[model samples]
Structures are given as structure tokens and as C-alpha cells.
Target: MVELQARSLRVKIAQQWGSLGLPFLLVAVVILFSFLSPVFRTQFNFLSILRFASFIAISAVGMAFCIMAGEFDISVGSMMALVGVLGASFVPVIGGFAAVLTTIAISSFLGFVNGIFITKLKIPAFITTLGMMFVFRSLAYIYTDNVSVYIDNDFWLYMGNGRVLGIHFPIILMVLCFVGGYLMLRKTPFGRYVVAVGTNAKAAELSGIHVDRIKIAVFVMVGFFVGISSVVISANMGVANPGLLGQGYEFQVITAVVLGGTLLGGGNGSLGGALLAALILGSLRNGMNLMQVSSYWQQVVTGSVLIFAVAINRLRYTLMGQEA
Candidate 1:
């Protein structure tokens, strides 16, 4: 009886360690950074890390949905750039609030286009999104006349930089996105549909699930999140440069989601894991800056992390006797 109990405890701990590994890794990174740089442990610097993490976390939540639906969006980085430039351009003519709304609508429409091409046209997601990436990025340049749109409005600035009771607005918005995503994915019927479609589309379809519609809806959902991210990014930078707004953003968010233990092939994911991974990434970047590491090396680190994450997932699948 004692042996059986001990085995059960071991299994429980193993399960927990598998699920909560990223948080532990995050804690370890924090401890290491704190030791390396006193500023790493400071409240102000901590808040700064949160601020940076918020942007990626918001997008990662949406990206997580896409991955969970057995699809991915490589165009997110370019989509963000296009939305940011477009949103910034409208700020002067339509006012800040209207501009924001317009950008989100455009983002949704673009996502809808992507869904149509993939679902209706039967194009693979990899090809569709990869093609859209260049198309959207080019459009941003064309629409903006290859220049940056400068928004000097105080309200726009406040959206990115303001704090309420010492908590930054972006951070607040990030938390809200995460909570909303978590509830939707875990509680709602739509969430179940997403998982079902991802886990096995043929089975889900035979079971009366609208797999195509769900995929489209998820694409639209992620577009909305990307729109929000574009606004925050534009506000933070004070300008929406077609070339710079969201460069490399897709990789960062993808890395965060994958590192958080989301499967690349879809079907399984955790928003909480993505959130923690985002924090870990943000913390690492900050720590590296504090250590005077060159900015170029960050890209190398990101690439390495992505490779490592995919490998880890593959190993997990192998151990579980499942296909990755």
C-alpha cells in the first residue's frame, strides 16, 4: 500500500513538473538575473519588464488560439506593422478612438481573408500565412508611402505609457486579455470546438463541428488581438514606421507560445504557460540589456530558444508514445 501511494505521488509530481515547468524556469531566470544585476530586482525595473511582456503576452494569447486550432499565422508581425501605420494615419482625421476601432475592423477583415484562402481555397496554413506576411508588409510600405506616421496626441501616448495607481495601462490590458482568453478557451463551447478541431478535424467534422467556421473565427480573433497590439506598439514608439512597427514580432510571440508548452501541431496548449513564457522572455531581454549584451545577440538567443522548445515538445511526445 505504501509503495502504491509513493508511486501515485511520483506521478502527480511528474505531471505537475511537466505542466508547470516554464514557471519554474522563469523563477530561476529571475533569480539568476537578480544576482547578476541589482536593478533586476528593483520594482521599477520589474514594472518595466511587465510592460514589455504585456505587449507580447496579449498577442501570444491570440496566437495560442491559432495554434490550438491546428493553424498558425506567420503574418502577425507584418499585420501588426500594417495596422499600426493605418491606425496612426487615422488618428488625425478620425480621432484616436475611431482610429483604433477602424484598425481593429481592418485587422479582422484581413484575418478573414486569410481564413478564406486557407479554408475555402484549401491552401496550407504555412503557405497562406507566409505569403500574407510579405503581401501585408509590402502594403504597409505602399500605404504609408514608405515613411512613418507620427502621432503626437496625448491620448494616444497615454494608451501606451500611462499608469493607473502605479500599474501600467498596457499591463492591465494584457491581464484582461489573458483572463478573457483563458475563460473563452476553458469555459465556452467555442473553446471546446477549437480544441476539437485541432485535436482531430475529421472527427470534429463528423461530430457536427463546423471546422472551417471555427478556423475562420479563430483567425479573426487573433486579428483583433494583433490590432490591440499594434495600437500599444504605436503608442509606445510615438510613431508607426512601416518598416519597424512589428518587425520580428511573430517570432517572439510564437516562441513564447511554444516555450509555454503549446504543441506546434496544435490540439493542446495553455494560456497560462504562454503568459509565463512571455514574462520569461521579457525578463531575459531586460537582463541581457542590463548586462550590456549586444542587441544582435538577442535574435540569436530567440532562435535558439525556439529550436529548443520544439525539441522539448518532440521529446515529450516521444516519451508519451504519441506523435508530435
Candidate 2:
């Protein structure tokens, strides 16, 4: 009876981890950082953290959907690089607004191509995205001749660095994206279909869920979000360097999604959790910078955190009597 009670308690904890555990962890991180550095608790610093987190969190929203739908897009980092450079190049010919729209369209088309190869060609997602990753990065380098395209458009600049009512635009964008993501995931039939497909594609197909269409849609979403992120990032930097703009971006977004309690095997996800996790990461990096931690060590710490998150996920699965 005692063992059974303990098991039940563990299951309860597992069930609530995504919604409850992540928030508490974020609070704890904030408190710890506030104590460690007097400058860390300032409103400016807090807003800065939010702005930084917004970049990863926004993409994480789409990544959550894709992973929940049982697909992965490892090419997003390269996609951002290619899209950023391409959009910046378009600024001279099409102007900023048109360039931004073109960026999104191009990225979406790339995602559609990925989906076609994965679903129609029956290629594994891993292989398809991996190949596209190399292709996209190469194209970016080729297009620029290994050069950086500088951006000077006022509208493009405002997207990432502008402020409204004293709040950073990126922060506001992040909140809006999360709200939209929440609504889409929890309040729509498409959301239900995604979950059903992720949970079991064969069963979802048997029930008429249109598994291929859902997967393709999710991939498109991944592209759409990444396109937004690319614009923001390039705006912030005022230039799009094909090689550097989105370096290691895929890892950061994936880490945020996984740490947010989205199971790698799909069927479940948490946008709130992803948002909080992104903030946590931003805070950690900011705190480490304040404390003068080495960049290499920061990478080590971030990687360790991802490993810890995966372990926790496995434990949650075990406690809930689900396969890891």
C-alpha cells in the first residue's frame, strides 16, 4: 500500500510538471540570480531578459507544435540564415515590408518542400531536415559569396529594437505569439488533430485525421515562426551574416521546447512551459555574463541543462508508466 501510494504521488507530480513545475523553477532561478547580482533585479535587465527570451520562445511555440505532431525540423537554424540574407537582399529591390513578407513566403515554401519530401517521398524527417540543413546553409553562403548583408530599413529595424509604451516590441511580440499559440493548441480542431496524430498516427489516420496534411501544416508553422525570428534577429544585428546570424539557433529552440516538458516522442506539449524555459535560459545566460563566466563554460552548462531536462522527462514517463 505504501509503495502504491508513492507511485501515485509520482504520477501526480509527473502530470503536473509541465504546468506547475516549470514556473516554480523559473521563479527560483530569478530569485537566485537576483541574490547573486545586484544589477540582475533591475527593470531594465528584466526587460532585456524578456526581449532575449522572446526570440527563442517565439520559434519554440512553432517547434512545440511540430514536435507535438511527431515531426522535427533540424534545418531551422540554416533556414533562418538563408531567409535573413535573402530578405536583406530584397530590401533594395522590394522595400522593407515587402521583403519581410517575401522572407516569410520563402521560408514557408522551404518548409513545404521539406514536408513533401518527408510525407510524400516517405523520407525520414531526420534525413530530410539534415540534408536541407546543409543545403540551406550552403545556399546562404553561395548567395552572399560569404558576405554579410547589412540592413538599414527603418521598418525592419523597428521589428526587433523598437519600443512601445516603454516595453520592447519583441517582448510584446513574444506574449502575443504565446497567446496565439495557446489558443491554437487548446481551442481548435486542428490542434486536436495534431495531438491525435502525434499520439498515434496510424490510429489518427484510421479515424480520418489526415495525418500527412497535419504534419505538413506543422512544418509550415515551424517555417513561419522561424521566419519571424530571422527577421527579428537580423534587425537586432542590423546585418545578416550568412554564417553567423543563426548559428546554434536550432539547438537553442529545441532545448527550449524539450525543457518545457514537451515529450520528444510527441503527443504532449506546453507553450507556457516553453516560454518560461526560454526566460530561464535567457536569465541564466545574462546572469553568467554578469558574473563573468566563460563562454565555453556557458555552453557546457546549457548542454548539461538539456541533458538534465531529458532525464527528468524520462523519469516522468517512467512514473506515468509510459515509454520514454
Candidate 3:
């Protein structure tokens, strides 16, 4: 009995170590940078890093739900562009609040369409989302005639540039999103159904879970948050350049999620973890900026991080003989 207890303790320790492995590495990076650069530890620098991280982190929050549900939405970047262009273009006539609602509503519809194609039409989530990515991307250009849109709203500008209770609007939004996602995933039935369907669709269906409907619902939720992200980005940047906006954003959010100990294979994720990863990535980028890292090198670094994170995650799963 003592030997069995010892084995159990060993296994439990290993499990915890595995879980914290990513955050540990992240902390290591922070320490290394703090030594290499004087700006790394400054409160102002970290605040700026968090502000930039908020944009990508916010998007990842939405993407997390779909990913945990064993589905993916590559078109969220395009959906971001859609919101920016749509909101910027229509605000002149329809008014500011109306424009926000309209843009978000349209993006939600787009997400609904994506989910339908994947679940109802049986096109597969990856393929459907990938195809829709191009479709929405092209639509952004066509709708805008390749022109940038701008809004001249004072409240929007203030939200983008102003701070509330000493916190930036984008950061506040990111925190709220992370909190909401964490609660939903940890304390709600919908989250359970998502995991059930992700673990085994046939079993979930047998158990009376509407797997496809859940997928659709999650997709819509993802798109809805993506719509908000567009506004944040637009407000911060002070322009809506659809042609350039949201480009590469999808990959960035996906990379952050995976790096945070979320498995790409699905049904396992943590909004808190993903948010932390997002902050790490943003810090890395900010550090790179201070060090004057080249744009091409940044891509190389991102790709390397993605490959390393995914490889480690897959290996952990293989060794565990189940979900990690």
C-alpha cells in the first residue's frame, strides 16, 4: 500500500508539472528579457505590453470557445475586417451606436453561416472556415473599393484612447472576456456539452446533446466577440483599413491559445492560460521592438514558437495516453 501511494503521488506531481510547464517557460523568458533589456521590468512598459496584448487576447477569448468545442474558425480575422469596414462606412448615416450593433450583428450572421456550412452542410469546420476567410476578405475589399474607412466619433475615440479607473478600455474588455469565458467553461452546462461533443461526438449525440447545434452556437459567439475586437482595434489605430486590418491576426490568436497549454486537438483549454500566453507573446514582441527585431525575423520567431508549442503538446498527449 505504501508503494502504491508513492506511485500515485509521483503521478500527481508529474501531472501538475506538465500543466505548469508552459507558464514556467513563459516566466523564464520574462526573467531573461528583464536582464537583457532595461525596459522590460518598467511598469510603463508592462502596461503598454498588456494594452497591445489585449487586442489579440480578446479575439482568442472568442476563438477558445470554438476550439474547445472541437471546432475552429479561421475566418474570424475576416470577420474583424467586416466589422471595421461595416461600422466605419455606415456610421455616417445610421449613427454610432447603430453602426456598432449593425456591424456586430452582421459578423454574428457570418459566423452563423460558417457554422451551418460546417455542421448542417457537413463541409467540415476547417475547410468551411478557411474558404469563408477568403470570401469575407475579398468582400471587405470589394465593399470598400479598396479604400479605408474612418469614423469621427468622440466617444469611440475616447474609449480607444481614454482610460477608465486607470485601465484602458481594450484591457478592460479583454479582462471581461477572459472572466466570462472562464466562468462559462468552468461553471456552465454549455461548456460541458462542448467538451462532451469534443471528446466524442457520437457518444454526446447518443446522450441527447445537440452537438451540431452547439457548434453553431459557439461559432456565433466567436464571431460576436470578434466583432467587438474589430472596434477595439479600429479605435486604437484610429482608422479602418480592411485591406491591412486583421491580416495575420488569426494565426496570432491561435498561436497564443496553443502556447497557453490549450491543445489544438480540442476539448481542453483555459481562457486564463490563453490570456497569459497572449501577454507573453505581446511582451516578446515589445521586447523585440526595443531591440529592433526585423519584421521577417518576427515571423520566423512566431513560426518557431508555434511549432515548438504544438510539438510539446502532442508529445505530452502521446505519453499520457489520453487528453492532456
Candidate 4:
């Protein structure tokens, strides 16, 4: 009886860990970095981490939704590049606000196209997005002639570099995005439909969920968020370089989504987990940089962390009595 009780207790502990592990790990990492480097504990550095994490976290919000709908979008990196260049180029003619709107609209349209190809043509998401990735990147280069478009608009610049009451604008935007994502995921019928579709498309369709529509909407959401990030990134750098902007961004955003406890297979996800994971990644990079770690070594560390995240995800599934 005692042995059986202990086993049950262990299972309960594991279940709790599965739910709360990322936040705890984030706290532990912050504390360790604080102790290791006095600068890391400083207010400025703390805010810097938030600012840096905001870029990934904001994009991760839509990614969480996309992943929850059992879809993938690897073209986001190139999408951002294309949108950034297009948006910046439009600023002088249409003004900053209008250009921002144009950027998001174009991105949403691109995402809609992706969804149409995936759903209407019945192409696999991987192949559709993979092909789009090349197409989008090539368009950016062709349009820009391999040149960087400099951004000079005051409002456009403020999106990334502005501070309000001593807090960066991007950080505030990140918080708002997460809050909105949480509400959408936890409080709405659409959110429920997304999960239903992801969990089992056939079942969801049978229940009148319009699975294809949900998938399309989620892809559009992914594009919308990536559009926001593109604006912020170009604003921060004051230029949009076709070849350099958003390079490898898909990996980073997906890593945050997966690490935050979202299953790659779909159905289950955590917006808060993704937020914390983004902060953790930001902190890790900042701390490593402070310690003078090499860029190559940072890549190695990030890769290892991704592997560990996958292992933990499987363990969490096992602990919850689910197939991984």
C-alpha cells in the first residue's frame, strides 16, 4: 500500500511540474544570472531583457495559436523581411501610421494565401510554407535590389525605441499581446475551436467546427504578429536589410513556443509558458554575452536547451498518462 501511495504521489508531483516547470526554471535562471553578474541584477539590464524578449514573445503569441491549430509557418522570417522593407519604403509616401497598417495588411494577405494553398490545394503545410519561405525571401531581395531601406519616420521609430514612464514601448506591446492571446485562448469559442481542430480535425469537422477556416485564420494570425515584429525590428535598427532582417527568426519563435510547453503535435499550449520561455531565452543570451561567451557557443547552448525542452515535453506527456 505504501509503495502504491508513493507512486501516486510521484505522479502528482510530475503533473505539477509539467504545469509549472517553465516559470520556475525562468526564476531560477534569473536568480543565477543575478548572482553571477552584478550588472545582470541592475534595473536597466532587467528592462533590457524585457525589451529584447518582447520581440520573440509577441511573435510567439500568434505562433502558439498556429501550433495549437496543428499548423506550421516557417516562412515568417522571410515574411518579416519582405514586410519590413515594404512598410519602410511606404512610409515617405503614405506616412508612418498608414504604412504600419499596410504592412500588417500585406502580411495577413500573405498568410491568407498560405492558408489557401494549404487548405484549398490540399498541400501539406510544411511544403507550402517551405516554398513560400524561398519565394518571400527572393521577393524581398528583388524588390530592394539587395539594399537596405532606411527608416526615418518618427512614429515608425517609436514603435521599437520609445519609452513610456520609463518602460519601453515594445515591452508594453508584448504584455498587451500576451493578455489578448490568453483571453482568446482561454475565454472564447474561437480559441476552443482552434484546440478542437488541432486535437482532431476529423472530429472537429464532424462537430461543425469548420476546421479549414480555423486553420486559415490561425495562419493569418501568425502573419499579423510577424508583421508587428517586423515593424519593431526595422524601427530598432533604423533600416530594413533584405538579407539580414529576420534571419533564422522562425527557429527562435518556434523554439520559444515549444519550450513554453506547447506540444509540437498540437492541441495543448500555454501563452504564459511561451512568455516566460521568451524571457528565459533573452536572459540566457544577455547573461552569456555579459560573461563574454562566444557567439558560436551561444548557438550551441541554445541548441542544447531546445533538445532539453523536447525531452521535458515528452516526460510531461508521459507523466500525464498521455501518448507523446
Q: Write the per-residue lDDT of candidate 4 for residues 210-251, one digit (tens) a residue.
A: 898999999999999999999998898999999999999998
The clash count of every prediction, one per candidate, is 0, 0, 0, 0
List where candidate 2 sits over 4 angstroms from the true fold. Answer: 1-8
lDDT score at residue 163, model 4, on the 0-100 scale = 96
Worst 10 residues of 2 by lDDT: 16-25
RMSD, each candidate, Å? 2.2, 1.6, 2.0, 1.6
lDDT of 1 by residue, 1-324 (tens): 997887676656544645667777789889999999999999999999999999999999889999999999999999999988988898899998889888888888888999999999999988999999999999999998999999887777787888999988899999999999999999999999999998999999999999999999989988999999888888998999999888989988998998887887888788998999899899989999999989999868767866776676666665554677
TM-scores, in order shown? Answer: 0.93, 0.96, 0.93, 0.96
Question: Which residue pairs clash in candidate 2?
Answer: none
Better of 3 and 4 by lDDT: 4
lDDT (tens digit, per residue) of candidate 3 on 1-324: 997887677556545644586678678778888998998889878778888899899888878888888888888888799778988888788877777778778888888999999998999888998998998889999999989998787655554666888778888888988888888888999989987877778899999999989999989988888887888888888888978889988988888887876766677776777887898788778887787889789778867876887777666665545655
Poorly placed runs, candidate 4 (over 4 Å): 1-11
- lDDT agreement of model 3 with the native: 0.82
The count of backbone overlaps in candidate 1 is 0
Residue 7 in candidate 3 has what lDDT? 65
Per-candidate Cα lDDT values, in order, are 0.89, 0.91, 0.82, 0.92
After TM-score superposition, the amount by which residue 65's alpha carbon in candidate 4 deviates from its true location, in angstroms, is 0.8
Ranking by TM-score: 4, 2, 1, 3
